[model samples]
Target chain A: MNTTSKTCLLLEDYLDGQLSKPDKDSFTAHLAECDACREQVRVSEKVRELFNQHPQTGLSDDADLRVRMALRREQYGKEPAKDVMNLEETAAWLGVTPGALAERLDEIPAFEIGGRIRFSRKRLEKWIEMKDGDILLQLQQSHLRKDNNLLQFPGGKHGKQQSGNSGAV
Target chain B: MTFSDEELMVMFAAGTMAAFDMLYERYRHRLFRFARSCLISVSAAEDAVQDVFMRVIRSATQYRPGYSFKSWVFQIAANCIRDIGRVERKMICRNSHNDTSGLEIDDRSFHVRRIVAANELDQYLKVLEPDERMLLILREYEGLKTETLADITGTSPGNIRVRLHRIRQKLAAGRSAVDREGEI
Candidate 1:
């Protein structure tokens, strides 16, 4: 009996002992008659054995300690803020509605303390570092300026006009 | 009798140093071997296993019950190996020059054959990507179930099964390709 490509892939799983008993029996029955699949299974088993025989390699003592220390520091670094500001206060600060501020919570990392969710002051400060606006609009403006510069003709002598119009910042 | 992995982890979480030590002993060799296969560097593998143990120590307090400790530890080791692979991508390049010819094997003929087999297998394993190698290590070496693999990898069990199937196919192809090249 001829086997499809999917069935052949299934045969690989069967040989790996990953198939259920019924599937295994079916696969074995098929393997009993199928020369190509049997060969594939043979090759797969040898590969598994070869992989098992390979020895393990390890990292250095110092570096291992460093990574562990780093992870621990990350986990225990910041104490959850106790006096979390209410949604109204946060929305007022951002100049957005409480619903809009709530939507942005997914973008900003926060932790819960005493059933009240709170954002780290440091994290909020970092968020403030970025210029605010639709990101695509900023990207489009930058792209247009770059194109206008590259497309400028030699000795067009429109320097004052270009600078006056382009110097929006 | 030895405690199960779950029991050991629970004990470790409760700050039992002995339980942590026993868990380390139980899985140290296996974890070392798993990392070594993924990173293909002895020092890197050692470092990865140590990092995993340290993470285990620090996160013992955060360990949730009803999860497989083996999968958790193996995932940590896998992540460490990935970081090493990213940093040392050039250093860990596979070549016959840096192959297992350095292992000192002065024993009987059978022992020598086993060592050679091991060496060949290591060279073959260097072909797989780090993620593929980790999956193979978890399933083949650690004997983890699909559910455990899913939890560790953060993928659905069905996806893990499919990925495992593909990984086995890739390894099988790698082995056969080496055999065809007369490298076996």
Candidate 2:
């Protein structure tokens, strides 16, 4: 490679102080001769300096503590804080096959500790409650759909009953 | 005696809380800052940092000592930040004046100018795509070696070198523009 083109390749390493003695020597020699390269080196150095100069940003003290606590909770699993059921126990309690429950382990709110997955009774109950809510919503939507269908077919028994009630009124 | 990060990772893999704590103490600040730079919000950064450590905890047994712990940990953090960015879809810049007051100064740059320039730097960073921003932050701010960056980014070191050159050029242009404005 030509000396100038080669020197350009060394700029990154030179700026990072990663160049070896021989390479550094040659790079500096070229820098002394080439003002453009010299200016580029100066600007690159200044740029790195500017970035390095900015203040060290870190999480706040409380944030650090919170993160540590959260990690500890994750590693230990949430079972220790309350009554918990192991995978088999939870599976039996839910009346599902162990293999089937294992398939839905992610869908269930469970924690893994010591390579064993455990389910928190409280959280599982809450999750079940949420699931029940979802079921209720689906039932309501299905009922609404049925009612709309019956309303559309006014000759149906339900629609005739409604029409008779309206005529009597 | 202080354990190497990889050694700590091994101990942590064996469920040693002390080792995990040591790792946390060593990396909490740097990782938080790394996340903050990427997510651009203190709260989001906080969440991302916590998620990163949680991932480490979850995957402790799966970590192989063959790799650099630093790169592995940062790769996890970068993934966490990207996940949060995708889910949140809102990148918030720190209120430079309010948030910058407590950072430990590394150089004697004029404080006001540094703040303004740093804010401008954030804006430019936000303009780039998330992956580019992560690449720049990891290389420039975190001072990760090119090899380590390549390891974390899953790219060749040669590719990292080329990309870093372009990133530095952008940073240099932004710095010059901000400096000129300060003079004006």
Candidate 3:
């Protein structure tokens, strides 16, 4: 079959009973004359059945708790404060000097409980990933792309930049 | 009355923690399963899903009304997985190659072996590229409509359909290869 026919055959709407009645009728007629497309549809249906047969593995309770706790931290700017750790211990777990951590303490996500500060391992890991070098590079590249796009499309709603004072000669 | 996913997202954007919780509860399992199926690593999947939720939290204010919340969420997840791939450069986790123990098939009968071979679903899927894996899982496992899959992956529906078809052929071939290996 041609590429267009192959792509058309992959449309799940006909096999899935999702197409409009008229569209479905046309598709059914088309399928009746096409053995290769029929086999393609059959295999796709089998793939769906195979997927349905497997049980969905869920997050463990601990993982769920960690996610919830992390959300709570994001929501409140700090968690309700459980398993509070001292600054040194937190730094130790993070493999950083307490002094270095202190310098960037505000950058780290932390919680204050009982007039003492602490950190959750989950939050710390997130904080680390947020500061991760790879993530930083990705963000940098994204910003660079956005900047390039902006530069390319100068003078949309943002008004054109006056290059060399536009007739200043 | 329980709110719909979109309603919950509106509430979540308004800083309603309960709405966020409800949304998480509703999608966590399916999202985790999709991520796990795509990444084939339990920890990586969990991290990817967590990052997806975090991005949703961060981008709540930018959400528009026209899009389906389900599609939006899965799009965030697809983007997250892609970003993970770009950063890590290694799509599958190291352990994915090592977890072949459970994939062994019996030499019983060809029919039985075919059934057992089919059961090694993950192994079969591993042959496809990351995008292909995402397309297959989203369509077959998550039962997402073609339009929504297109929206999530930012591809034309026709292209997504073609990719899904290609993935199906690849998976079938992978399974057949496994069956041949078993025969030997």
Candidate 4:
């Protein structure tokens, strides 16, 4: 083929903006002179316009949440969240007796599948997160009451404390 | 600090759900657009995108930081769409032979009118094989580089460029042309 025909064949890459700078410049120079190639470029640009106008459908507002949930389910299902635990397992995870846990079942987040109470490790985690702060606060206050030093001694009375926890502290 | 897709992917492998979430947020819409364009049916396209993410997390541990994560997930989506297309094609074959009425959901004509009646390219896309259609979508619409398209499609860049040229020629032949003497 002649040079013009060869350049005409580069129309796809030219319109795609894939050509290197010099090649693009040459193609641009060629487009100015070549009628067939310019017309082809116009049609290709129209094709591009069609692509631009394709109207991407159904990426609804919840698509992220939807796919996210789907991925979560897949990940959880594959990894086995081991998150949902039976009453006995949940009690074991919580370091409580099953009987003790049953007393607090109403307070804990749980669901009954087939009449068997199960707890989500996720919900349990959040529950622990909420209550652990209070538990920690209570423990800190109890320690503070014993020491009476947290306020009195801005610097902790580390040496004055002769408790068994002296080494731990 | 903002992380690259590859960085986020590596972080995701290290068990950061936020990294995965970031990856999801970046890709969900783009993947949906590609899937919707090629798969035609909205539900199938959505399922394909969901399937892509599922595969992403499932294989996130295997993702290397050296590769482009965009290419990685798109390859997964492309494979997912191809798999769905294969099953649908078989059903279409059976449905065609049996003249089945109930399975028309997968019918190209029905879906063309329902979902893509207005997109002029969709008609031309109908004539393309799935791979060619995907290649065109990735290259032209998605603005993926020839090398990235190569990586996603598992072909050489030269092969991609050649295919793109041929596909464009086919599309131009199929589309109404600009007049030789007049402006577009």
Best by lDDT: 2
Compute the lDDT of residue B51 as modeled in candidate 2: 92
TM-score of 2: 0.63
lDDT by residue for model 1 (B1-184), tens: 8589889889867854446656765776677667665664566666777678777877888888978887788778777778887876776565563364334334566456656776666666667776786787777666677778898899987788677656656666786788788964
Instruction: Please report how far candidate 3 places residue A120 from its true position, in Å.
Output: 20
Q: How accurate is candidate 2 locally (lDDT)?
A: 0.67
What does each candidate score in C-alpha RMSD? 20.9, 18.9, 15.8, 14.8
- Off-target runs (Cα >4 Å) in candidate 1 are A1-24, A33-40, A52-169, B97-115, B172-184
Clashing pairs in 2: none
In the range A1-169, model 1's lDDT, one tens digit per residue, is 3544555657536755779988888888888877667665664566667765643333333333333334323332333432334443333333333334455567655676665666565655566665353532333233222222222211123223432332221
CAPRI grade of model 4: incorrect
What stretches of model 3 exceed 4 Å from their correct place?
A: A1-10, A20-29, A78-169, B85-119, B172-184
Residues B155-183 of candidate 3: C-alpha lDDT, one tens digit per residue: 89878877777777777678778879999
lDDT per residue (tens digit) for residues B40-106 in model 4: 4566677888888888888988898889998899899999999987776665553222232322245
* Candidate 3 docking quality: incorrect, acceptable, medium or high: incorrect
| Whole-model alpha-carbon lDDT for candidate 1 | 0.59
lDDT of 4 by residue, A55-155 (tens): 45445544443454455445445554466776534543554433445555677889977656678999888977988756434332332122222211111
- TM-score of every candidate relative to the true structure: 0.57, 0.63, 0.62, 0.64
Tell me how far the alpha carbon of residue B60 in candidate 2 is from the true structure, in angstroms, after superposition.
1.1
